[model samples]
Target: MATLLLRFLLKAALAFLAVSVLWVGVYRFVPPPVTFTMLGDVIGGHGITKDWMSLSEMDPDMARAAIAGEDSRFCAHHGFDFRAIGNAALRNAKGGRIRGGSTISQQTAKNAFLFQGGGYVRKAFEAYFTVLIEALWPKRRIMEVYLNIAETGIGTYGANAGSIRYFHHDASRLSASEAGRIAAVLPLPKKRAAISPTGFVRRHGNTLSRRVATVRDQGLDACLR
Candidate 1:
């Protein structure tokens, strides 16, 4: 009986590995059709809103703004940023609310492959998928997938959709300020609005706008280039 159970578990694990590898490999060239988060939004009646735009079609400032705001060392790190993780751990230790140290690559992995917000089990899967994408996809493809799939507003997904929803334009030609505003809403898209931001959101958007130029100047997104 114990041997049978062990065999079953081993088969299950192997099946998972094979399927996940195939999924990641296919997404290397094909844009993902849907994700768990998008489905949840649809179920909640928020409806799906996404406009897929290739990285090449987007204005350079948009990607630069993301690099400046979300992960300054996006080009430097592999799948994880240990320094940021260490900093987040220190902050969480003080214990107001938990924070994550996820890099854009890790976020991409989660957004692409897994459902949102779970405990250690989900995190282990997230890490595994992150490694898989980093191995199978190029840096540019990873950025493209993240930009296209990220939740930008309540039910809205991708920079182009967010741009149209907020700025009445697509992401094809976003200015620094516009890109910054969209990027600012990324951390808490449901709570924030790029149309009329105030307080920290406004300030952070402005900061990100300025940093966009710096990111370009410093070549922080060199990997995408």
Candidate 2:
């Protein structure tokens, strides 16, 4: 009985490892066609549309804008940014849920591995997969996955799809301002339209634009370096 139990455990461990390896390999090579998103059901089951854009193919401005808008400490962190997490915790303790400290790596992991929800189990899974992705994939790959899978519009729209739907252009052709605007809508894509400029959207877009310039002036290569 002991030997049988040990064999079962070993097989389970091997199966888990194999699944992990397969997930990383598939994400690295093949672009996913569809992604699950919270907005899908909210918007009448419209699937989240995604377009695969490689890091090499995207403009530096787009990358900088993304980091500036989403996670400024993205280049420095591993899977999670403890500072942001602490800040978020403090806010929550004070009876506020002001900010989300999800890093690019964490977001990538969530988008790729789990369903969206606000629950402890989901969050735990997010953290676990975030660590795995950070260990298995490069920083560039993480950002690429995030940009592709992140919910950028209300219905059946992702980054590339949102870009085309709003600006009438591809994500690769997006200017800094356009990219900033797109990133700005990320926090409230379902409730807001990317093309329509609300006060909050405009403010966020302007803030992102300034940060993007700062990122560029400091040199994007410097962050990676």
Question: Which candidate tops TM-score?
Answer: 1
lDDT digits (tens) for residues 111-224 of candidate 2: 777777869998987887888877777787787777777778766355777788888888878888888888888777776666867788888887887788888776643444
Clashing pairs in 1: none
Residues 1-225, candidate 1, lDDT per residue (tens digit)?
Answer: 999999999999999999999999999999999999999998888888999999999998888988888889999988899999999999999998687788899999999999998989999999999999999999999999999999999999999999999989899979999999999998898999998999878999999999998998898989988
lDDT of 2: 0.76
Q: How many pairs collide in each candidate, listed in order?
A: 0, 0
C-alpha root-mean-square deviation, each candidate: 1.2, 2.8
Compared with the true structure, model 1 gives a TM-score of 0.97
Candidate 1 residue runs with Cα over 4 Å from true position: 95-98
Q: Each candidate's TM vs. the true structure?
A: 0.97, 0.86
